[model samples]
Target: MKTAVALTIAGSDSGGGAGIQADLKTFAFNYVHGASVVTCLTAQNTKEVTEVMAVSPNMVKAQFEAVINDIKVDALKTGMLFNQEIISTVADCIKSWGGDNIVIDPVMVSRTGAQLIDDSAVEVMKRELFPQALVLTPNIYEAQLLSCMSIHCLEDMKQAAAKIYDLGAKTVLIKGGAAEGKNKGIDVFFDGQGYTIVGIKAIDTVNNHGTGCSLGAGITAHLALGKSLPRAIASAKEYVTTALEYSLEIGSGCGPIGHFFPLIESQYNG
Candidate 1:
């Protein structure tokens, strides 16, 4: 039997908790073969991100060509394209290759309220990349930015999801993990027709550094394994929730969710 293949085009996290590392771990946990195209490198830990450097557009394009040329990627996801040039380069590569089952995790703002991408990059992402996405997953902060509205309730999330869906994503998932009150952990999914509210039990943890990236990669892996878009989203949500439940307490600050939680559990169970 052939293993399903999934690709991640994102940044490198020195902390090994997010970006390409997290995406690969999530893909592996889903039983998919993972490929990667690194667009940037970050000197970051659970504590803070100190520095970041984007790969040149030429190198980013080269990486994409090398990966997609040999491997048959059943699905792919993008995360943390830090600049306009990288975003445009990736978009062109996706167009040249084929945009099928592409999950775009708009990594504009961090969970710590820091902006990761510049405004120009955001514009390029929406204009060049979003329309090609099969699924666009944005956290509450990113959703607010994309939709130009504040999200404080489920209704607000729904509206934001709808508004973002208009921007050309076939489906939009507005993650409400950072929401307050009764809306926390309740995500709104909009697929141009109606809305579905996806909610899971909230896990209280400061170790959620890679939740967004992992979720997007999980969905891509599921898609590679032949699940429908909505089904993939549902499965990814469950995977992230479980991973969060077993989040690792590493470093002096916010840790990361356990992408390989099942394997870690088996070490103890056995």
Candidate 2:
């Protein structure tokens, strides 16, 4: 039998926590073959990002062509596009390839709420890449930036989702993981017509280093497996929650969620 393929266009995380690393792991767990095109490289660990070096736009374009020409991608996700040039290159390539089933994880800010890319890059992504997305997944802060709205509650999340949906994406999911109160970790999904609140009990852990990447990749993997948007999101939600439950406290600061929690559990049990 042939396996579904998922592609991740993103940066390299030396810590093996986020970016392409997380995406591939999520793909593997979902029984999909994972491919990647690295836009940049980050010198960081579970603690913090120390330095970043981006690949040339030409190089990024080459990688994309190499993969798409030979392999068949059922679903594709973008994460941590470092600059405007890379964003434009990726957007152009995706357009030329006629690739759909896109999951865009607008990774402008870190989990700890630190800005990762410049405003110019963010602007380029909003203009060039966002409209092409089948699903746009943004955290509360990212949603706020994209929607230009304040999100303090579920109602605000819904409003933000609608606002982001207006930006050309067919669907939008505003993640409320950082929201306050009892209803934290809720995600508002807007499918151009209605809303679905995806929620689970928020886990309190410092090992949430790659939550966004993992969730986005998980959704992409499910989509590659021919799941509907709503079903894909639901499966991705459960996958991420379980990974969080088995998160690793390997470093001093924020660590990474266990991308292969079930595999690890089975190995230990055996």
**Alpha-carbon RMSD of each model:** 0.9, 1.0
lDDT of 1 by residue, 1-270 (tens): 999999999999999999999999999999999999999999999998899998999999999999888988999999999899999999999898885889999999987667877888899999999999998999999998999998777888889999999999899998877887778778889999889988888888888889889989999999999999989989999999999999999999999999999998999899
Worst 10 contiguous positions by lDDT, candidate 2: 109-118
| Candidate 1: residue pairs that collide | none
Q: Which stretches of candidate 1 lie over 4 Å from their true place?
A: none
The count of backbone overlaps in candidate 2 is 0
Model 2 lDDT on a 0 to 1 scale: 0.91
Q: What's the C-alpha lDDT at position 236 in model 2? A: 95
Please write out the lDDT profile of model 2 over residues 152-204, one tens digit for every residue: 88899999899999888889988777777876788999998899999877988
What candidate 2 gets wrong by more than 4 Å, as runs, is none
lDDT scores of the candidates, listed in order: 0.91, 0.91
